[model samples]
Target: MNISRRALCGVALLAAVNPLGIHALASPSAPKIRVGVLKFGTVNWELDTIKHNKFDAANGIEVEVVYFAGEDATNVAMLAGDLDVIVSDWLWVSRQRSEGEDLTLAPYSTAVGAIMVKNVSPIRGIPDLVGKKIGVAGGSLDKSWLLIQGLARRDHGIDLGKEGDVVFGAPPLLSEKALSGELDAVLNFWHFCARLEANGFRRLIGADDAAKALGASGPVSALGYVFREKWADENPDAAMSFVKASAQAKKLLDESDAEWRRLAPVVRAEGGELEVLRDRYREGIPKRPLAEEERDAAKLYEILAELGGEKLVGEARQMAPGTFWAALKT
Candidate 1:
């Protein structure tokens, strides 16, 4: 779907307040950064932290949180100028740039999902998944699913999608099915995978490991902060401040268990599940240098292109230049 600067798309949603009291507008003195987040996305944990602790105010901006139901809604809200920023994959940014859109992405998280199986399941590797039911979240062309397919093809010459009985559904539903023994294995989002681990599921393989086998340098940022390039150029200070505040929020989350305790209900996890989510989230914080990340991202994009084909990448055979914001702090 080609989107011009003025034209946007849509999805519907309802809103709810997080435990942290939300400040919807900038104070009379501070510049505002309108951020659109999925109503229940993991990104909200950090956004909530930033707002609750006044990190944005400290960094010289106010972050006004807007809620969206899905990526399409966030993309639309962003293009319509209702939001200054949103979290999205760099591939989408690359495709938009290739199509002549002036957009860029800042690294967010490297938390790719994993392939999981029941603790007693016989599936030990990609090959063992043959003839078993595999539940996949994010549909057929899901990036993690595609990576596992690429790895399977590269290493064992089998297409799991064709060999296994594949089931696609929402993450929560799939997680439930996997737990109930209705599915023999699952490839799901990281948080869901982490939850499964807490519930006795063993990871068969991680997307990051599959990516490494296919030549990615290390953990790749599957999602990031995306925004119009013009906005960043015009409001350089606010842009930089948001980045700094985002980093500070991540540092805090990484260091303080008390903060996680505060965020527990927000993420809807507790006991072992909450611990798994916290540890996995902290481990996902992007640590690779930007240049190295960019290179690895480019490599991963090529592999993804081979696996997902044109429908996924939308006309770019390679990741476009300037796909990642060049000004990220080292």
Candidate 2:
């Protein structure tokens, strides 16, 4: 009573159309999640995962990544509804909210953005910056600048918020200007700070340090996990999933130095590297998001208020719209 060859072929054909069997073998891939990130520097970990498509397989997430060289470029894209998410300084979100841009802060992303000066220059500290020119990326709106500005006011009483006290110039020119001695120093993110330090620039206190000096009890240079508010409202589950996956990724990076070391070249490829750049990243990365709202963040809101961003104060009080943090439970 052997089965015929024709009968076996017929059974194979049926299996191809059988939903139960196909589903058991492999479920359909998870929907792709598009993420927008800064094009260069300390954002290496997220970029590496996106570049290698690592998260797609591990977390059942497909990421469509878009890169921008500066905050303005990213802000424009966010305004145009071109991005599903953005990872950047929370300061940008504060400014956007102040200006009435519709976006939601997902969670804390990173805890670092710094500024450095040349080692041999006369600019020994923030006090020396009194008459020296400085380069800043986003004029007065840049969060890094605002944090440092708040610091100068609090610590040194120089008040960089004023005109001609500290010059606002593009970031790219800072390195060249610092190297050639054309400029005294500059405010930059951590990765560039490493470069400036390696090229004989001295550490003039990072944004995190400045925040602490100004009496911030916890993390100061907080990076916000952000996206369009309308998008999050429409796709609550997807947004929740994104935040969950991002929290997982941040945890993985935090717990493993070997994994971080493996990612340095990827950072270098995305942008130029200076000595101990990876170290700078590791030093800055935090293990987890705050379980509750942070006082320091409220302090940041106050800083924005001083900067004439009253609307940011209102939005910071309601940073996370959805109660999705329950998903990040260990």
Candidate 3:
């Protein structure tokens, strides 16, 4: 996840058109907006739906969906101006803003993650995770991991990083390790956690549950759509259009299981995997953006800042004002 500038430059040099045959670059005659995305994330499904349904064309813009392997690649692309927008955590957006980068975030999904264990395991709750081998998806600095650390410290007076043998790996590998008994529990991203649940794993605690224990008023979404302030200022209509289109896609996802079935091929999900993803998507789809004044948002920020330390959000303990794009409120 530590992407040096030179490495990013190399990636840019080697970047190619999307292999899926979706347009890699927008037409010059139209407003061209390049969006960086991960092939397996929820934004991938939403963007694919938009493209397949001609939503961008209907909105008077040409969107080139650029695929990235991870957040590092996407961050590099966006900073290099190869991408106009990206779906990322609000914490990243806040960090960028702290460094004087003009970034704004809008809600994507409020789906928080979960701690999953085998159904037969003796681990019944967060307290039981003490002295356990827990597999973490993503690095030690991951927001969810940080939040869980905070939860552990507050709820049971235990420092999870000190008490538990935490192994960091990719979601798939974490799932594999947890299922095979190599790890006692796995703190995974929502999608993989859903898959584990579908395979009969039981959730010890979800993100929302942890957040509430740490004093959040309601659910908090870690992911959102991030864009540069200058770009939004210059292309106001395009920005609004993109948000509207994404909102439409979210609505479709929220309203119809049939839509999930239709999108399975596009999302590259199959059989029971498709059903699992559908359920996860339904659980994650945000009803609306989190309000800046809400207690939930404030408490969530506090937890992240306190637990994540300087590694996550720079030296700032508070989220930069205007980090949330209020234009989307309309």
Candidate 4:
């Protein structure tokens, strides 16, 4: 397999502005942190790399990981007292809080999602989606897709709740149906999106552009690190340590090219063309969480509350007063 020019350019761009520091791996520590994550994507890569390379260990921390195929599985495990940390979407935290589900926004992970449709589908834009059937990965915490739909509803005065106007399904079905021309669109996470595109599905719109249209100031992040409320309350020190360690990993990628290349595949796996996946990794992942971006999360919550026909926005206290660990510095 050969790398794309865009991927090559992406690698070069990342090398020029490496803000996440990639230092020498740290030594192993005891009582490893247990984290449950979605399987075999960029996020899985990050968690696995951190565990295998002893990135947490180097910082005097230990990490244990569990993998699941879907966000619902991770949420179910978290609710069952089986996980210390889980990687999920930010909007999910808000919706969960609004519904009185117990969880907290631990940290921002990544800000991207993708919309896939048959390469020849008539759906060319958001407005084109009226009366069309679309699929979403059921129980996916990646609410950016829903957020985009909500924004479209608000801005265009359209209603998706009406029968036959919109439909939702899991990622596998989304892929299968779209390929078979049974769907107008499918919303999926990053790596899945890349694979779908490679399979000839055209991207109708992406979270990045959707966020902007909805008035987001900077790039929007979707996935976040979340911890159960009880677990966090009992393990504040561990929580802080976890936050700091993850931030350090982000910093490593921000600063070191050699480190980014080594870690990029952990996010996006390429069969043989490592460069293409590496390029996608560099451009797609956010180096670290930003506090200022919490406003977007807040805004997303407000939108969901309205769409969900709720009275009050969920508690802000649930989200860490500081969005990212480093933000607490000021």
Candidate 5:
């Protein structure tokens, strides 16, 4: 095994600048936070901004991104002590904590999808959806699905799931079906819905609106940066620094149109689709305080639990203690 001077120097420089201070490595300069994200997730947009602008370094932390194929894979990696943080919903974080695993969420995107119909479709609202062929992405336990069901039941006096000829499929597949007129309406994830909108799909009701209709304060966070609470406590500086960097990245993205154009290829969107994505991403940013968000989540938890049952919410009927990781001050 031969090591060249350049390679050796590179390794030395890495060790010198990194101060992760836990599990993977020890360094004195600045702590490194290993962040696991979906390979093509929207979170990458913000992370890309952070890395491109050196926000992590400016905030006194170094970010190491590890891409995963799926959310479940990242969850396994987190529990196996292979990652420091990952983007996930508070629902999963609450479930993990309830089961004694001690996972916590830092508010990220509040973005959620909508029930969309082709512009010419007769379906205009929840009541109109009765007996219509509706496609749902992300299966039965998807929070948006359950929230819509709850809203339908509350406002329209119908088990919307039962009333509609519901079909469950992946987001992309459903989006295509809706676009081709194979489905009357479709409930898909945010990005998929954005694309559909760009292609002339009309939203019947957004998930955020459903949450509000069902008594949530406003749009609650659908996803966040999740971490092991014990690990976060041990590395408070790193944890807080990463949070600050994420906020800075989001702020930059919120204000810069040029940045959106720069990230076009990364998102695989352009023209109207790109514009829609940028707008949706900005809409999804968590603007409310932690307390307000947590409170809204608590309210939504009850409705979701009623509609989705033990499968969606696990044994815990509540949102679980420490689900929001609020103690780590931003």
Candidate 6:
């Protein structure tokens, strides 16, 4: 499912109904948390689940979801206090913390990503990627791209950028290029990978594979819900309520295919594509929020440092303390 289309649908729906206006007229009995989200991202599904199921209302908070066109826009809004929370990666959380932003992360999903190729292609593993044209979804500094680069060097003795021709673009474009034979394989975000597989591509390796090779104790989710420290501090109960609602939605995704089906329109998936997406969501959902020590921020810093060098994380091999928002667990 191309997430952008679904995001547009969400925006259109929001515009038509004026959810914010409706919320304003409702009884001002509950606290409100304004959440920033992307129009065409996976976060939309989870947020929609929470809204439709009235999870936030059940938890005594009025959830207001604000939409953005891209990450930069969402980041700016969050920084400007226009949003109380947003879905983002740990790297961004770390970078923000390094700059003294006092943002914290709670696990959203652990399903990192995967590299995919045509089923008939002879590229059976990452090792076989040498000298091949590979498509990457994000930019050169994208965390998954860097992790794959690091893993290729550490586990396969290959520097993918120097040894293989890497082309970076949007996930949908990468998938199109790979399918058209312009690239041998593509490393894409999980949702894009699921869409490609539904269209006949095959997974060569997953980000979890790279993490395992990097010595993680278990699966580590790179994405999470990020919020300002001050906001969380002032509204601790509301923050926990948000986390609890999100966790409930995650559980529903993990346990019920019916829930996925129910969310099909929100995610823009149907039939076999819906099933593939459901399976991917199940595979990516984290079992729990990461503990402070369990986050392994140091190892991630090392991987980013190795692949992206000073350009990504500067001279640091460890992120600032309080990056993982461990209080959610407590």
lDDT of 1 by residue, 1-330 (tens): 121222111100000123232243223476788999999999999999888776775555779999988989999877778889999998889988999888898899999899999898878888888889999999888988998998998899998989999989999999999999999999999999999999999999998999899998788899999998999888877787788778878998999999999999899999999999999999999998888889998999998988888999987899999899887744
Ranking by TM-score: 1, 5, 6, 3, 2, 4
Q: What would the C-alpha RMSD of candidate 1 be, to one decimal place?
A: 7.8
Looking at model 1, residue 48 earns an lDDT score of 95
lDDT of 6 by residue, 193-264 (tens): 988899889999887777767766677777888998888777777787788778767877788787888898
Highest-lDDT candidate: 1
Which residue runs does candidate 1 get wrong by more than 4 Å? 1-27
TM-scores, all candidates, are: 0.91, 0.73, 0.87, 0.70, 0.90, 0.89
Over 264-306, each residue of candidate 2 has an lDDT whose tens digit, in order, gives: 5665632335236655655655544454335466666566666
- Looking at candidate 3, the ten consecutive residues that score lowest on lDDT are 13-22
lDDT-wise, the better of 2 and 5 is: 5
Candidates 1 and 3 compared by TM-score, better number? 1
Q: Give all candidates' CA lDDT scores.
A: 0.85, 0.59, 0.76, 0.60, 0.84, 0.78
Candidate 4 ranges with C-alpha deviation above 4 Å = 1-29, 39-42, 68-73, 91-103, 119-122, 139-142, 160-165, 228-241, 244-280, 287-289, 310-329
What is the Å distance of residue 288 in model 5 from its true position? 0.6
Can you rank all candidates by lDDT, best first?
Answer: 1, 5, 6, 3, 4, 2
The predictions' CA RMSDs to the true structure, in order, are 7.8, 9.5, 9.0, 8.9, 7.1, 7.8
- The Cα error of candidate 6 at residue 125, in Å, is 1.6
Error of 5 at 188 (Å): 0.6
Model 4's alpha-carbon lDDT is: 0.60
- Give the Å error, residue 306, model 6: 2.8
- Candidate 5 stretches with Cα past 4 Å from truth are 1-28, 328-330
